[model samples]
Target: MRIPLSDDNGHQYRDLNGNGVLDPYEDTRLSPEERTEDLLGRLSLAEKAGLMFQTVIEVGPDGDLVETAGRISKSPTSEVVTGKHLNHFNVHQIATARQAATWNNNLQELAETTPHGIPVTISTDPRHAFVDNAGVAFSAGPFSQWPEGLGLAALDDLDAVRRFADVARQEYVAVGIRAALHPQIDLATEPRWGRQAQTMGHDADRVSEFTAAYLEGFQGASLSSTSVACTTKHFPGGGPQKDGEDAHFPYGREQVYPGGMFDYHLKPFREAIARGTAAMMPYYGMPIDLTVGGEKIEEVGFGFSRQIVTGLLREELGYDGVVVTDWELVNDNHVGEQVLPARAWGVESLTPSQRLAKIIDAGCDQFGGEECTDLLVDLVENGEVSEARLDESVRRLLLVKFRLGLFDDPFVDVDAAERIVGRADFRRQGFEAQAESTTVLVNREATLPLASSIRVYSENVRPEQVSEWAQPVATPEQADVAVVRLLAPFEPRDDLFLEAWFHQGSLDFPPGLVHRLSRIAEHCPLVVVVTLDRPAILTPLVPFVSALVADYGSSDAAVLAALRGRIAPRGRLPIEIPRSMDAVRASRADVPGDTENPLFPVHFGLTI
Candidate 1:
């Protein structure tokens, strides 16, 4: 086979756009047959092996998540970047301009190697605004600033979503990112469920609507020179947990549908498929309690399930794109779909190696958030995995990479990226989104739009911080409005949550604090904005505030915009905010979000 080993000396690659040079404007759309032949012909066995993995990235000097973040480990990112062959990388965070440059330079060098040289498919979690989680790790980095998904959802404008996705794509492509790891489209059915705001809203219908629109925005209307591919996530619907907790934690891993009454949950995935999403990610918690043919199936995410991915998505939905398992969960390496546990058992049972094998065999084409392609190569060499399997995945991956036009123009125009990303127009759009998304919840006293002369006090916000709006105040008596920013409680844990039962509970926040704030709100017209990861019980504060906004993911811009009326508030609540803790506890824990005793129904929002 004619192999393309080095960047400059490979004939296996042919320039597609008929351009004499490999420039940013090259077009890579191929007829299905032509695309297959090109991708196959360009990759040698070794190179194809390299394309199977979509690995995790390390941050900082300390490679461990437990220690300091923002550094790459000496092992793979250092090693993989050196050998110059990788399919995908999910950056932890680009800490410095130097780090960003180095990472880009590595991918750039790799792209410069082959005939139809493919650009590295880099991706990231949310990086625009506040509450950076499994996506970007560091607070300070070379990032394009914007609002979170909820903030974007609040904007409820197709133009704004398009702008946000465009900027994100520009920022990513500039730094060699071709794939976007999110637009987590799961419906936030349960309010107290962690990661609720990450979605567009609670209704499957709304979530479906927003996700379809977002997929278009993020990926662009088509896979052209400038558009980045959107990876729509948590297939077959991920929300409706037993306790509104994430499945990443053990206590929240069980997915309950309540006798399959909500059988239409997969409505969004069907839409995503119809909309031509570039990729799919199975969530950690979503597992069908029943089994096909009478075997108890247990796995964290749906991507790892054949019943979910192969049977439903590929066979029924006719989706011919890539399917990758959620990070940290798919560790078992499989032998003809027979999954085995992992190698790194640090008080844990499985290592990533074993898990990797199983997931590949189980029909997962790519490994999301993995850092080591070498591991897959090793397995292939050791006779544990097959070359055909690797080839299968590589072909699918390369197809998308080709579709992304990475094969032609891999290098990012940093200047263009800067110009397009985080532009004043986009930021203004985010502000508008926040305002529209923010629902007042209550306006009995009509205390909203407090005069510029009114004072405010908050737990997280200082008196001086509100000085721009009004004078500093010492007590609730002195303030005309008491604005509070509350944080969602959490204890970051592993994706599977294979820990003790007690430790596997939903995030805990301070008790009776909302009530205390309510007392202050009762006296004065107050606006409470919950800066949280999950839904908070708000019955206590209902009587106190004239306006309320669940500032999803601590989007300060969204919060500010809503209050300032830069954009009209229109975002319906993504989850039903409960009335009390007892109500939540009394609801079915077996089927967390599937329960109907919500303090507030889905899309419950009040406006001034």
Candidate 2:
């Protein structure tokens, strides 16, 4: 066990400085601001610079510290913490709940041995969701699995959203995870936007209300030791991509406002700001030819745009929280065959050092997915970036750690972690939520509420799970009813590293898919469940299918439960199902509910 020291008032504290005395920065009685001030005064320029980069770090097999570099993490865990002094990390890929807690303890033990003894603040993308996109979110490996963000929006229940968030917080805190890199409030205004599965939906008012509940759930009444600080993200909106392409790649860098509704996108963020979110992240997309409030906004990415970051978010909106940039805006990522260049967007011509200067000047507090503290230290030493400016960010960062009680104790009980994470009650609630969020778009002649005695032909569903509800047949021709699950269509691209993971491009079902489903429909009364990661064009299959349904990251059991009428499908269309791809092309990027003749409008659903 570790030893501690006591001050004059007999309040015990960690001897963080290792000088055998209680330092002002280590005092538990002092306010976070007071502790931050004392710590800021003591930190060297290099140490302060390290706090600005929140990078990825992987755990070793059996929950040990990673001694060597991995595919995603640039350096080993020890190098980043002890050598480079980076404390903030986004952890990925844990085998079990115990492993996660052990890894965190090992990491904090390492941090304790460092010069300042600053505890690491671990953050994660939405891990409870079913979609496992490495660039966006991970799978629910050891946590209770819930539907994606769109499913939560489909439920349209503020109480349910709050409950999910609160449960997620408990699971996260158990594993020593202190920050949530989510509650992604970006509205799905653009139908073909690839990242819509993680968004709340297309409506501004509903998204705003949910955003408040989400913040309350994660951060609790306020950010405390038990609470998980949420980084409500993609500021100034990332949904209005030009031609519906993502900003991760160079070709998709432009974010247009053709409908001139730029202000409309900021509605949810206004709620996030009002709810006191712990951090905010600017997106990679650069606004194109945009003028706001009679002034022309600069055509730089929001991460490097002072007009968006400092002027709009900080000064205009009066948001004083830590502003973090989207990942890897300053450095190129080259992992084996996969190569992703830095997302500098409009300022692509500038060097990495110059880009770093610009990000700081734009008033960002941290650089996401970056580990170039040496570059930042050099910038400050060269007078390109001021030490005073570094202090401004470091103060905010340290205060968060202090407020989280990381200074008091960063360790968690490994036993408690195993018990609390993915508890039986939590899993039951998640499965129920999944079933409740399944939207019945078209059910002709009372085709749904399937009888348990009916013969079933399953596609993209587990045979054993299907056997639980109805007789599972080998082929559609052998069954009385056919159940097929299809993912919303997207144009296939293998050029970019993370492009395959992002379900982008066209929403129209490919010609081959239509032909295949047509064949299956002929064999029996078809029951098609389309996973709506993006708003899909369902016009071709509308006439042929007996029952049409939509799901956002639900399990086979959950979907089957709804199909069997064990649970009712209460979800509605969070976004409209467009009539055709032509309608998608003609619609404005910034406008919601703009699809000309949608097959199914937003909030459209059928009950049995």
Candidate 3:
């Protein structure tokens, strides 16, 4: 199990390729750029092609390598790493910190056996938050749990955001997760968009400020060994979703800029590039007859648009970091009986191979959630994509690996991972953040900070946790007050793989639910708390409810603490709460704070 070491002038280095002499790429003292160039020359065409794709890889029970392909992953871990020669992977879940460390070490061992011994660079979506949307993000498992991204935005504290990111970095680094697929900087301009919870609010300036702190926290001052390279995502802004529909499906592929505020969304990205973000991810949405600065944008997905990726991001912004496409842009995803088609958008007619070639031509470095090294290799052999072009991307990818110190040592200490991940201090801080992010929107007649002796009729509030605050009654009639918890309403759809998981469509509460809450208010003063994943229309409930509260992602305990004055609510609304669905429809998708006569504007919050 001992990795053989080579020495050159008393400096020992990992003999990655099993060659006796110390290769220039294996030299520890050399700069990343120099080492990248040395390794670039040594790589075969197939090896270089493999570096262009990053796919999903699931860990087996107890950190064992999966022998078979998973539901979402197209190939097993070994087949993708060794056979396909991929070095980057997006890990789905980690059962435990020690197990994650073990899995990472095992994966690196597999990579070490390869011809070049390229260590795998593990990445993950935001996993320190609530909500377990499989394709988007996973819930915290053996990791310190924190509020969702919107909760952090609700707090709007740069120091707090930096602390959270640093904690995440420590946890990720312990388990050998080098890349963080997050800090989703897309402004929540459209209230009905499903992915709004993952973004900062519609304010460009605040989002831009938070972005600098975010990059600083995740990657430190710069991306180094101690850092988790942050991929500030959905570049050129994915906020202006037409009809508030996501671009993951064919129906929601249009990203319109009807307000002619196309440059407005690019504000945070400019900050990201300035802060030295490790990577960028373009959204699946294609501009729909959109014009930016008097230039008509090609009606292709951002991943396939040369004007956007090459001309705008690369040339104009001068960003040389890796550019990864959103998931499944070239291949259709097969989930059970249903098939989630590729998000080719304007270029849907192109073949899978053609799509890959175009993405490369568009100046992308790697394919997200894809494993098609053979296809890329064929493209090079058939003269569609030149090998020199592949080097440009591969070189960037290798530089990131080198700069991250992966080439020096990829293995992690299993014992250290267990001790550092989900430590008591980290968990306590996360719980406090959850409590602090509880935004009290309406407190009519000072209804909150309720007496502990008061009898409470609870709905959706946990009976055991509610008992700690006040007496829990079976019916509203037997109680002095009613405490109810509700999620912001969204129209349900189950067409695609992750469609149902994403809370898309209408933001209006159902008539029946509103009627039930109104009836409860007649018995006693009602305290209704709704989790505002997206800004929900609260016009109907505002009249009937005695007290209205909003939270991004909070636990029952956190809410109870805020209600009982144990922990005061410090959160403000990050985005406006629309008065009605009519106002939402009339507002420009690209413009911020454009809703007419909003019930509660951005940064609106109250104390008990």
Candidate 4:
């Protein structure tokens, strides 16, 4: 299907629908709303159904769309784009920026041959961070690596936040990712939650400020061709998961709010809406008897709750942006070797068609992590779902595509992509931020700012890497100062879909590790650094070390620079470090900093 060209006033216009004449949707001169209405009117029921489904996709080494070889859905990209009519995809695992750009161009070329010439909109989770969770976010890899979201919060500077987002926006655009499935605005209220590293912090006001800044940086003052549209999620907040488990598995499906702070969790989302975030995503965790505005809402996942999605987010808040449900809500998925059940928490008893209908009724526009457009088409044809309802969602989805300028030109400069991604200047900025984000928790007797000539024995720091500033010693007794790096403690679990990647459960260190650290401390002045994904209970181990530092995905070089005084440690605690597991169990899951005698309160940091 070749797009016809029309000549007018020395300019050319594309007949996107190959209709031989110019249609309103093909005219770049018209407003996005006008074009969306025209295109919505022209699309068939099947095409509209295709616009409603957004699922994960993979690109092969040759920059061609390929089937993913995992437990996740492996729909052929060609079939999904042509046969099924899906234009939205969440891409994963491309080798480099050049490869990603080539893949994106190939995908757009495929879409151009469609009857409507609807250019595909590719989205991705956060990919600029160091942590690599297959089920959540990807590693920096070939892109400039920055500190995690928690580290950004630790810096507590809006300008720095803006810079980070702008750099990320440029990188994403270079690789042809029009939509960012990130800027997770959920406040880190529960210290044990595994996803806290992706949040700003525990304070509502602070998180709200960062949320607005992030949207401004990614989408700019307003969305345009140069901007990467941001999806602020998980809507109404997803931080209060019961027992700190994620909602990806059946065991982690429940979200409890014992402190009656549901409204508090919604504050950042309210800010995100006001900032004009392009889209929103509801988490998979079902709220357990959550009450709002003196009325008790039903116990269901946010994606399936009419009161929460329609009554609260739509009616009360007046947000009209696209609401995409969190991944795999309608069908079970294979995550690693384990088979994870569909995260249809409240609607578990409903059939797949019934669940799809309920999600539409709940005011959601698109289904994330699902490729089953045929089911939606079947429902519309059978009168299970009205065509008008489908139009409502298609209209919103089309508006986003038009606003992103994807319908006009969706290609990228492959050579420029290689130049812009992980460039020297960008890498330098990321390293500086990583160093600035290193939080000094304790510095008794001014032990830090150690001389560069001191003999150093390191536990986790690579000897060759630390040799830049200090003499490397084999044992603690042979060194003047002993520096050690350890990850925050987590209870290991073997479950579905790379559950081990998540640092959940108890935060206490094992007795053997504690004894080893104490033994090293007795031999020399000990300096300890912990990479925090969650707030580890450090009261038992804090007594042994002379200096304590906290890092959120900083490189080894950045950590050494902070200790050597080449970089100042200015970061603060984004989430509270509880005194013990007992206090964490007693604290309210929805409340921040409610633990009794926490080891370190929110925003606690020290600087020499």
Say which candidate scores most in lDDT.
Answer: 2
Q: What is the model-wide C-alpha lDDT for candidate 4? A: 0.88
The collision pairs in model 2 are none
Which residue pairs in candidate 4 collide?
335-497
Per-prediction tally of clashes: 43, 0, 0, 1
Task: Give lDDT for model 2.
Answer: 0.91
For model 4, state the Cα shift of residue 194 in Å.
1.1
Residue 449 C-alpha lDDT in model 4: 75
TM for every model, in the order presented, reads 0.81, 0.99, 0.99, 0.98
* Candidate 3 lDDT by residue in tens digits, 422-470: 9999998898898888899888888888788889999998899988767
- How far residue 214's Cα lies from its native spot in candidate 1, in Å, is 0.7
lDDT per residue, candidate 4, 148-246, as tens digits?
999999999999899999999999999899999988988788878889888888899999999888988899888889999888899889999998888
Local lDDT at 168 for model 1: 64
Better of 2 and 4 by lDDT: 2
Scored against the true structure, residue 489 in model 3 reaches a CA lDDT of: 95
Residue-level lDDT of model 1, residues 404-434, one tens digit each, is 6666556554555555545566556545554
Better of 1 and 2 by TM-score: 2
RMSD of each: 6.4, 1.1, 1.0, 1.5
For candidate 3, the TM-score is 0.99
